[model samples]
Target: MVSDTEILAFFRGELSRQVNRKLQTVPLELETLLQDYAPADELPYVISDYSNKYGVDVSALDMRNYFPWENLPLTTRLFKGRNFRASVIANRKPLTVKMFAESARAGRWLYD
Candidate 1:
């Protein structure tokens, strides 16, 4: 059985490599690498909260199933991937796992 730790490790290495290499990529490419960590059907939902308050425009989601990959839970494996929809990020920009996770958690989009 492939342990989750192993999976996480491999992904961690890959992410580190990308960072170390200073590689520039689009959200689509990041979406591709994200597969190493999350199962096809298991990717977290990326909700959009235009404002920082009680309102989520579920009707307009940028990424189909794009959650912040960095917010992954290695132990309990319980990550509520959520992100806000900002003008820059919502557009076609390079996606960061950290930013996505932080935005999602802050916006409380996971509940949706």
Candidate 2:
């Protein structure tokens, strides 16, 4: 995985670089806060949970990240919402939100 510094370096040659550059300058506490973001992978019965959360078509969610090395499917199921209990009941593996976004950025997954 690329470190935050390397990601910033990749975005350095642009006029609108401040957005990406700002991550590097942020205080550790603030960085940790933002990095706490997570994807919705553990949600069991996502097809229904998403209906309750967004009211939009969950199937419409095509933008997803997947780790090629893990052979995980690019899925909308991971973006619905939290269902930790259901996941436990179903015996599903949990995936972090960060990995999902990174996968999309790296083109391991694609939206329709």
lDDT of 2 by residue, 4-65 (tens): 44333322321121233447532222123211222233332432442343243445333232
lDDT of 1 by residue, 1-112 (tens): 3333433343343342323245563222323445343343433232122222324233433443444333335542333223432322253333334333433334433322
Q: What lDDT does each candidate get?
A: 0.35, 0.33
- Checking candidate 1 for backbone clashes, the offending pairs are 82-104, 83-104
The local lDDT score (0 to 100) that residue 27 gets in candidate 1 is: 29
TM-score of model 2 vs. true structure: 0.21
TM-score of each: 0.23, 0.21
For lDDT, the strongest prediction is: 1
